[model samples]
Structures are given as C-alpha cells and as structure tokens.
Target: MSHASEVPASTPTIVVTGAGSGIGRAATRLLLAQGWNVVLAGRTEASLLETAQEHSRALVVTADVSDPEAVQQVFLAAQSHFGSVDVLFNNAGIFGPSVAIDELTPQQWDEVCRINLTGAINAARAAFAHFKVHGGGRIINNGSISAQTPRVNSVAYTVTKHGIAGLTKCLELDGRPYRIRATQLDIGNTASDLLNDFGATQGALQPNGERMVEPTFPLQQAAEAIAYIAGVPLSASVNQLTITAGGMPHIGRG
Candidate 1:
C-alpha cells in the first residue's frame, strides 16, 4: 500500500513557457502543488522566480519562445536540471496592440506571427523530440477563443491563434505513434491581467460596432481545467477544451 507521496520526486516533469504571469503562472502553481516538477521558462527571471517561490522542484530558465536557440536551451535546461521533461505547457504568447487589418503594419503582423504561432511550433517540436527520447509526454497548448472567432480590431492576434489550432491538430495526429499527446485549451475572458485590462479599457467590442464589458471568471478555473487534462492517463487525453466566462459572447452575440 504505497501512496503517490512515496515516489513523489519521480513524478512527471513539466515545462511551462511564459511562466511569469497570468495563465502560465497559475498552471505552474497547480502543477507544482500536484507534486510535478516544473521548469519555468520566461524572459523575466524575477517573475518566473516569483511563480516558483520556495519550491525545490521548480527550475527557472530564462527564455524567449520566438528564438529557436532560446527554445532549445529551455528544454536543455529542463533535462539538465530535472533529468527529463514529461510535459510541456506551451503557453507563451502576447496580444499585440489591436488594430484593423488594413492598418496593421507588416512588421506588426510578423512579430505576432513569430511569437504566437512560430513560438508554439518551436516548443511543441522540442517537446516531441524530448518525448521520443523519454518514451512519452504530454503537451497542452494555450490557444484562445479567437481560434474559433475573430475579435474586433485583433487581426494579428486572432490570426496567430487560428494558427495554433491548426498546429494542435497536426501534432495530435503526428505525435500519436510516438506516444506524444497534444491538447489545446481555447481560453476566453479569464480574470488575468490581460482580460482585466480589457474589461477596464475597451471592454468587449461587438461586430456591430458596440462595446460592453464581457463577464470574466477566476483564472484558477482555466488553470484547473488544464490540470485536469494533464492528470488524465496518457491513453485518454483531452484533444481540445474550451473554458470561458459564463456570460461571455463566445456563446452568442453580435
């Protein structure tokens, strides 16, 4: 009669990108609290450290996901510190300043595409390779409600999110034979800094050129949903999950 605590240190190791704030931070905490070792990857050491405070199993790696070499080092650091990487919460992303498609500069579009779409691809590739070496692993990508529906004045951001959905589906198919499982969480209107700022500022912009504050729920709800996906047996992974505010327009609104 041995409990999970008996071999807790042998629990799965997870890598979390964008671990500095918001959803990444919340997911890292939830994973660590569940006795999983987490590698914190972010450009900011201070914020990553803050998320990993006083946790011995947490390893902090400063990384910008858009850089190929930097992305490699993050996984290398994970292997170096934790012996192996069993899961990757590929959550690094940014909502570039909203602007109409006609006004969005080429550079602006490139930057968002590089970080949001290319970045997720890089992390997933690294995770897939690592999983092949280690026998198996899980990848949970942080997609957005934008994947299903474009947002007002969010041309660049919405396009990148749609790319993430396509990537997630491809990974699910490509990784199956190698014991690598991929899942996408299409999140919306969680009470994070980004959503809160939206609530305070532009609120919700309707397709008909109106604005209203969309409802929001606790960040923990999304984090916990991720944990649930990660906790399931590898043979039974959740391919896609959408968690959003109860009253969000994602359900129906012009």
Candidate 2:
C-alpha cells in the first residue's frame, strides 16, 4: 500500500497506455500517489481525463496505440510536459472475438494483432529511442495469462499475448547496453471491465468446454505489482512476473 518511500529523490515519469480503465487506471492512481508523474494515453480523451482525476501530475494524451505516429506522439507529449519519461507501460490492447478458429474472421485476427502486438512494438520502439538519450528507462508490458496458456475459442487474444512475450524478450536483449529494462506481467483473472464483459463474473468458458465462474482479484493488486516493478532500480531487473487469483485455473489443470 505504501511505495512513496521507495521512489527516487527525483520524481520519475511514466507513460501508461490504456490508462482509461482497469489495470492502467489503477496503476496510474497508485503511481501518482507514490509521487510518480504519469502520462495517461488511450483512444478516449474523456476516459483518460477521468483516470487523471484532476491530478496535477497526470497528463492526458488521447492516442490509439495501433498507430505508430500516435504512439510516438504519446511519448513526445510526455516528454514535453514531464521533461522526461522513465517508464513505458505498454498496456493498451483488445481481446478480439471469441470463436472457433474456423469461425473467426481474418479481420478479427488482424485487429487484435494490430492493437495487442504491433501497438506494443511501436511504444517500445519509441521508448527505446528516448531511453537511449535519457540514460535509461523501464518497460512494463501488460501481458496476459493467455501468453502461457490458451483458453478455448481465444485464438486472437492468445496469439497476441504470446507475441507480447516474444516482444518482451527482444526488448530485454536489445536494450541491455542502453540500460533499458523490460518486464512482462502475465496476469490472470484480475477484475476489470474486460473480464466482466468476458463473462468471468458469471461464468467463463473452460478448456473442457464448460462454463464456470472464476475467482478474480482486485485491480489494486495488479497495480501494486506494476508499481513494484517500476520502482526497481536499473541496477537490477525483473524479467518476468506472474500474478493471478489463487482460485484461477491457471497454475494447474482445472
């Protein structure tokens, strides 16, 4: 609950994509409370402003991460306002249609890839450019449990998440000389608007083809994990971290 003391003497600035709601919103609030300046980026200006909550340190930047130019603008705006950016939270993503592979449309797959995979790549590239000049920076990618295991009828979402894992590894390897650290948080069943829409609150589809309600943890926990990783010094790095609801059927066979 308390991370203010862990923060460096100088205020750190972080750019969080998908800051409009869910984990991004939660992490932004916590980061602000911990004395970090955050630039909120997403497709909706209104939601990003809402997430800002009139915080003096929060800058709202409306951007669709799928656009490389827009993603570059998010970092540029952050630098213009905050002077510098210390971390990039690549969290903007969409869970495409949930249907069998044969039933899935090509457009649906492309949409998910554009946002989930390509979007993260764009942000990472921009951040890497900034970090090289600024000395060092961190990137915390919001990967999903689907990165490691796939659920029934979740081809698009799962594939993009797996792609994110690969992206994370590439960043880590490629950014070492420049002090750019990358970490992927593969979270599971965190309560969010997306989860509710996916029917987790009622019952989610199981791999066994059955529907069952799954336990979900609060958004604060996931946010806290992100904050912890963000606060770590560049001298050390957390390559990957997995946080999940204890009752979620991810650790073992359901």
Best by TM-score: 2
Candidate 1 lDDT by residue in tens digits, 1-254:
00011224366888899988999999999988988888888889889888988587788888889888898998887776667888889999988867798999999888888889889999998999889888888899999998888778888888899899888888888888888888989998887887743442356677788888778888888889988888777887679999888868885455
Off by over 4 Å in 1: 1-9, 196-202
- Residue pairs with backbone overlap in model 1: none
Name the 10 consecutive residues with the lowest summed lDDT in model 1.
1-10
Candidate 2 TM-score, true structure as reference: 0.95
Q: In candidate 1, how many clashes are counted?
A: 0
Query: Model 2 over residues 78-97: C-alpha lDDT tens digits?
Result: 77767889999999988888
Task: Give the whole-model CA lDDT for all candidates, comma-separated.
Answer: 0.83, 0.88
What lDDT does model 2 reach? 0.88
TM-score of each: 0.93, 0.95
Worst 10 residues of 2 by lDDT: 1-10
